[model samples]
Each structure stands twice: as structure tokens, then as C-alpha cells.
Target chain A: MEVNDELVDKIAALAKLEFKGEEKEAIKGDMQRILNFIDKLGEVDTEGVEPLVYMTDETLKLRADEVDQEISQDEALRNAPDKDSDYFKVPKVLKK
Target chain B: MYTSFEQVKREIENGKTVEDITRNYLETIKEKESLNAFLEVFDQDAIEQAKKVDEKLKNNTAGKLAGMVIGLKDNICYKGHAVSASSKILENFESLYSATVVERLLEEDAVIIGRLNCDEFAMGSSNEHSAYGAVKNPHDQNRVPGGSSGGSAAAVAAGLCLATLGSDTGGSIRQPASFCGVVGLKPTYGRVSRWGLIAYGSSLDQIGPLTNTVEDSALILEVIAGSDQKDSTASTKKTDAYSTASKFEGKVKIAVIKETFETDGLDPEIKKNLEERIESLKEQGHTVDYVSLDILDKLVPTYYVLSNAEASSNLSRYDGMRYGYRSERAEDLESTYVKSRTEGFGTEVKRRIMLGTFVLSAGYYDAYYSKAQKVRRIIREKTDEMLRDYDFILSPTTPKTAFEFGANDNDPVSMYLEDIFTVHSNLAGTPAISIPAGFHSNGMPYGLQIMAGSFEEKKLLGFARTLTE
Candidate 1:
């Protein structure tokens, strides 16, 4: 598939990233080249084959619904770039 | 230049205090500062930990890894210590809890010397993508040490630390080990816990060891591998006594993958070394034959598709709200995310995240992501079938030895292709290792890769020890 500038913009938006003017052009070329390379996967006949999501045959192990360990609220919010006393502080989601 | 864990352990037993050993490594780390291997050296904490180990040794109650100085790749979390994954997005981020592997190492009295540098979020083939800057090859300062665990490999190669913990997704650990002329092992996918490791590709990533010798690699694996309640994907299989790997004696059937040697861009010197190694294995009574892996051409593409798809989803949490780098220019939530991510991630990371977004985006998911998954299963089944007949698969760890800086800086495809031989084991979910085979004419070291079926790390490591010996 041809990865054009419009598609690049869409992907960048979905990825929550914005490229500068020249970066967008370079990213477009890179995306196109990489996509073309990965396009060869379509040639392999995967008829009746299941998609392998997990490498191991073992299913995800279940644990009893109990808190084995707990961290204080201060510890939980320690790495937040901007955090109030009990919660993370983000920029306004709703504009006036 | 100490190569074995036993040598260090013997010194400790012979009255060389753990504090002295730790101080020696700290001195080497300072002296070799130009290698740019470590992001942070835990000098004070390491010395204190060594004192405790020395106390234990005095009481004759030392642990398996007592007094061993080790380094952790920046991605592995050490509680209350910085773990950035060598990216600005995680700059100044301190881990709240240690990784299970880190906890295990501490339990065995391993003195963690420091956190080493790596590719940004473990994305690039060369160490150039690190926010801190590139790590130079120890053999020749102008060349790369092969990444994304470049610093971990280079540290062990240069004796900055005896061994280091590095996570492998695709070829992160093994490729760097090959370039740096050290031993690196990527165990079966679920063999090691991924709990406190910063996730890049959830499915493909496994934490392993880079060491100066295969026995040291085996010892580290034995300590770190097991089921973890915190990591559901960690295997529930019983952990083997990997330290006893030398006891196993058998003539194994080994297949040299024909397509790997025939691939374009493979250095002729590496090919010759692999050929000679095969002859030597045959002379030692092991059956060595050439096998054609038709799916070899598709491995790089399949690996990129799946790994990037997972990376996009995994990295979505790095938005400016909770943790990591935040942009001051943002006035709103959406702008915060976009601006923070744009300014925080490096070019290679952005390229991958964009590629991942494109593959997983609407109207193209089936064409790229789903098809790649199906092809992954095909590759896995083919490898499994081959392993059913052969005991192990052998190939060159990388296409070439360490290359000069800016060699493939402009060409991402060439860098991605460098992982072609190593990614297969990750996709197949099998255990594989890279051992220094010989030096190139340029004097840089190359490695021979050995892979075995899933959960066969003991056999693989045992045979690797034989080859290295």
C-alpha cells in the first residue's frame, strides 16, 4: 500500500504524535519503504493457519482476586510528571 | 580481565573482600568512561551490598552469585533507582519496584554495579538511538557495539562488569553480544519473567544475560528463570539446574541453516568461520548438516510487523498524564499528548511508532498485522518441525562484525536486516545463544548462533560451552 502524506498524518494523529514539516516528508518515505518491505508477507500462503498471538502453549495463569501487595498513594503518584495530592494533574480536557 | 564467575568467587573465598572486588570494577568503569557503556554507576549502594556479601562469606552462608558484580540494562527496573530505557520519554523516571530478575539477582547476593545504556526503548540495531548517545565498540572505538543491548555487551566485553542483564526482543542481546565478542543467551519466550521490565514488544521480549563466558550466562539464567506470580506469561515449567550444564554429554544433531549463509550481505569471513565450526563439530561426533529454511527471507518483515504493532500499543501509555516526559508548551490534554510524544521520542522510535500505527490502523489491519501473525505461526511451525528432527539449529549471529559509526545510519532497512538471523529464534519462541566464534580481518569479533527447541536452554547452553571450550 502507498503510504502518502495524508495517511501519515492520520497515523501520527492516532499515535498522538506530530511531525515537523521536513520530518513528515522523511517519515512518509520511511513508512513507504518499510511498508513495501513488509508487503512481501502477503505472498506467503497462510491458508487455514491460525494467527499466533502468544508464543507458549500455556494459557495465562489465573490468580485469586486478592491484593498480594499494595503501595501507598504517594508511591503510586511518585513518577507522575504533574500530580496533585491524590491524583495526577493533567491539562484541561474540556475547553471553555 | 576476568572471564569466569569462578575466578571472582575464588578470590572472594581466598580472602579478597567483596568490597575490594566491587571497588576494582568501579575503578575499571571510571577508567573506561569513554566506552559510554553505563548510564549510572551505583557505587555507594554496590559497596554496601558487597560488604553484606562479605559478611555472609565470613559466616560461610554465601549465595550462588555471591560477590559477582553485574550491570543491568537501563530498561530493567531497580526499585527507587532510575530506569529510563535510554529515552527522553522516561528521562528522570525512577522505578517504583524492582524487576523479578533484579530481585532474583539480589537474592543471590549479586552486586549490581550500575544501569547500562541501550537503544531507545530497545528499538534500534545500533546504540545510536539512545538519548544519552551512542556506545562505541570496545575493540575499535569507531564502530558500534551492536544494539539495543549494546552497552550491556560492551560492558562485559570490556570487563566493566563481569556480566549484565539485558532484555532481548528480536536480536537486542545476542546481536550486541556477537559484535562485542561475548556470550549472550535469549531463553525460551516465557522462561524469564517480564514483570518489572519496561515493555517494548510484549510478546517477543525476554530478559536474558550477557556474559564473558557461556557458564556465567547459564548461571545467571538459572538464578533468574522461573515462574513469577507477577508475570502471567512467565512459564510454569520447573527451573533446571543450569549451572550443572557441563554434566550433560551427548552427540547432538545440528543443522546449519543453508539460506542464512546464502543470504545477501553476509560477510564472507563470518561464513568461513561458521563453516569451520561445523567441520569441527562433525569431527567431535556431532552430526552437522545443511538445512534450507525457505521462510528465512520473511523473518525480518514478520518480526518488524508484529513487534512494532505491540510496541505501538505498549507505548501508548507514555502520554504526558501519568509519568515520563511532559511538554510545557501544551495547554490542553490532546496537545499535551501530541507535543510530549513528539518532543520526547527519538527519530527511530517515532518511525517505529508510526509504522506500528499504520499497520494496526483501520482498513489495513488484516492486510498487515493479521497476515504477519499468520506468517509468524508458519515460521514457528517450520522451526518446530526442524527441531523435532535436529537437536539444534546453527547460524551466524549477525550478517557482519561491528561496523564503523554512521555506517548504516541513513539506511533503516539495512539495520533491520542485521537482525535477520537472530529474530527467528524469538519468533519461534526457542532458546538461542551467541558465542564468539572468531575475529574478522578488521579485528572485530563475530559470533556463531545456536538455537534449540522451546525450553531447551540447558542443552543449548551446554553445547555452547563445548564450542567455546
Candidate 2:
């Protein structure tokens, strides 16, 4: 559970966040401490126990595929930080 | 200051208009502005709502919660209102629709006075992590009002509102209730619908009430708990008559978790108060015994791993392009994601997201995420077996009373340990409540936590009502 700067950077990348130099050091320490704490779960024997993904025992309710209500494109893009009249604007993913 | 639901109802019945009551709460909120309990107060909207309620009262067609003023945790959505999870990323994001709980409150004629402050994304135990700022405890300004439902508890304690709706993912509501000397309840996970609650840990999170009394908490729970088509996970099970929870008369079988009392961090005063409460319960003819939970030490760690894992996934939707704060400095799509997230999220949130991503990542998925999930099943099974025999499980809500600001800010692990007694119910998806049991020597209040089997909120509240009485 040794969370080095490289691992912290890798995790941060996956999480879509960046850390400055000093913040990275501090977070590395924090991650290591937390991981060390969580490492105790390894001691427990979970041999045949199925992982409890959901708490309730009820089966997922399926519904017919139909458009019940619709939000206009204007309403949909209301909160978008970068948007045109009918579309959300984003930086180009594919470079020339 | 107004104390109970009955008192407020009596005032309205005695010719006090709903407008008068709403105004009083607004005045109190303004007077206690230094406490930072509220993020925004809906003065005009609340007055309009109250006027309608007054009209209903005159026509003798008022709903059950007519004239009661309530506050909402910032995370719960009210259509067209800014519903930030006390995070910078969502600081300007407005809710597109009302939460099921909010809609239910409006139906019951409950006037939502304001949105209260909480931890950023409900990630931290203390309110200090909030982007708006930490909420000071009404009891002691220097100490924190325990969070992430700190403002909900403080507003109730300070008489700014009769009650507040707070979501409890892991002790968010109850811990603050304990610190503020009010009642906070976290209903069974599926008891309340999560349709418009900004998701944190979807499975662990539940919407509940923070109020001055146990009866008030029960009344709110009764109004909000039920099935919703929007939330498929919301139980199809019939909602209980929770309002009558205080009417039950029986000798309750209570089991005090032996391991909780033995914990090293438990304050001596809290321990004494809990022991006395147990004695009083026994004196009242309720059977009480000690039960061992050998996995007590593992609860906090297990909770953090599982909750953070869910949180990372749930929060991924907050990327810059969709909504919320976007970086103006981004030159590419990847930088837009990274820079927006880096600037938007606070330190604690970033720490948790990274931790979550790490555990759920390849090479460590089974070692951390899967292992924690397996342990979670064991915890749930053990709790279920105990509940089958025992009517309720009793313990201290927190190991200690509220601490001074920044006391555990640098030590996140220690702060996470504060949830030791409360997170078990969230993991098990059972109903649990925190009631003001006693005051600590430091002049702050601590609470007794009572937990029951899943969807047994009526029984749990009945026993809590009896204990509080």
C-alpha cells in the first residue's frame, strides 16, 4: 500500500484530476495512510462469500422502453458550461 | 425559541398564520447568520408557500405538515433552486427537478425555508470541508457542528427551522444531530427515494430528517418514505405508519454492542451516559444485554473503501463539459477534464476520488474493492442475524462529542473513525436514529444511536421515542 508520487499521479489521471508538486506530496502521504488502514480487510477470510454489490434483496425492476417525458434541447443544455444553440461545445478530442 | 412540532402546530391552530411562523423562522435564521447554518434562505418563495398554507387552513383543507417550516440540506434538489453539494464544481448548478422528499414535503404543506450547508459532496465527517465554509456549532462557536449534515442539525438546534432534511451516506445526519443535541434519523436505504438527491454513495445514501424531537423526525419520515418509479431501487414495500411510532407499548429487546463501549477513543462521559441509559432502559422493563461484534475495528475502514468506491463512480458525471465549473485554461479535451476537476474539487474530495479510483483500478480491484464488498456482506449478515433476535441495537452515535475546528483536519483517518458507530447501519441498509442522550463535560451534546432491521423504522422510532421520553 505504498502510494508513491507515480501511483498518485496515475490515480489522479484516472480520476480526471491534477495535483501540484506540494499537493501531490501531501496527497501521496494521505493515500498511503488510507490504503494502509484499508489493507486490514485482507486479514478477514472472505472465501466463499459473494460480494454484496447492492444492499436490498429485491430484484431490479425493468420497465418498457418508451419516452414518457422529454426535456427540450434548450433545457438539456441549460447547465452546460460550453454549449452552442443546440449542442454542447467541447475541446477537440481528435487532433489534426 | 420554538421547541417541538406540536408547539408549532398549536401556534398555527391558535390563529397564528403560516406567514407569521415562516417569518419567525426567517428572523431567527437572519439573527444566527454567524453560525453559517444556511446556504440560502428562500424568503419570497417560503412566504408565498405559507400564504397558500394559510388559505388551506382557513378552508380546513390543510395537509398534515401545514405551517411547519423546514430546511433542506444543499444536496437535496428543489426544482429551479441552486442545489450545490457544497462543492465549488456545482456552485452554480441549478436543480432541474425536485427531489421526491421535497415534493412530498410540499404536498404535506411543509414550508421549505432554506437550503442548509454541508460537507462538499457529503465526503467529509466535519463541515469544514464545505466550499461555503464550516458551520459553527450553536452550542459552541469554536467547535464544529458534526457533518456532512452539520447545518441541518445546527439549524434545528438554533431554532432557525423546525426540522431539516439531510442525506446520510455514512453518519452525515446522525453525527451532526449528536453534536447539535437534536434528533437525526437515517431511514433504511430504500425507505426514501433518491430520485433528485445529488448522488454520493448511491447504495449507502438515504434521505432523513434532523429535528428537535424524535416525534418530529418520525412525522417527517412518514411523509417522505415510499416507492418511486424514478428510483427503481426504492422499495416496493409498503410504507409504515411512522407517525404513530411513539404509540407502541412493549418490552423491547435491546442488545448493546459490547465492542463499541470497549473502543479506546470513546469519551468517558459518553460511556457513562450510555451505561446509565442502558440501566434506565432495563429499569423500564426492557430487556438489555451485551452482544459482541468482533469486526468493530474494521467498520470504519470497510465503510471508507466501499463508500469512496461508489462516490468516485457517481461523481464522474461532473466532468467539465456537461455542467458545473469548467476550466477556461484548458487547451485540449483531457486538460479540460483534469484542470476543471483539479480546480473545482476541494482537497478532501480529491483525496477520496483518487483513493476510490486506485482501489477500483486494475491490479488492485480484487485486493481492495472486491475484498471490502465481501466484508460488507459479512457485516450485513451478522447484523441481520442479531436483529432477528433483538428488537434494537444500542450504542453511542459517535465516540466523542463535537471537537474544535481543525482538530482532525490534517488527519483524515482519525476523522473517518468518528463514523465508527453510525456507518454499520448504512452498510446494512437498516434504519438508525441518533437521539440526545446526554451532554458531555465540554458542554456539547452526545447521542445514543439505535438501529433496527431493514424497513423496521416504525419499531425503531417507537423504541427511540420511548428512550427519549
Top DockQ hit = 1
Residue range B1-469, candidate 2, lDDT tens digits: 7889899888877889999999988999999999999999999999999999999999999999997899999999998888889999998898888999999999999999989999999987779999999999999999999999999999999999999999999999999999999999999989899999999998799999999888889999999999988899899899988988765597889988899878979999899888988898889898999999899888888999989999999999888998999988877889988999899999999888888999899999999999999999999999999999999999999999999999997889999999999999998999999999888878999999999999899998888887778
Off by over 4 Å in 1: none
What stretches of model 2 exceed 4 Å from their correct place?
A: none
Tens-digit lDDT string for candidate 2 (A1-96): 577778987888899998888998899889988998999998898999999997788887966778866567777799998899989999888898
True contacts kept of 1: 0.89
lDDT, residue B80, candidate 1: 85
lDDT of 2 at A95: 90
CAPRI level of candidate 1:
high
- Residue pairs in clash, model 2: none
DockQ of 2: 0.81
TM-score for candidate 1 = 0.99
Q: Please provide TM-scores, in order, for all candidate models, with all chains considered together.
A: 0.99, 0.98
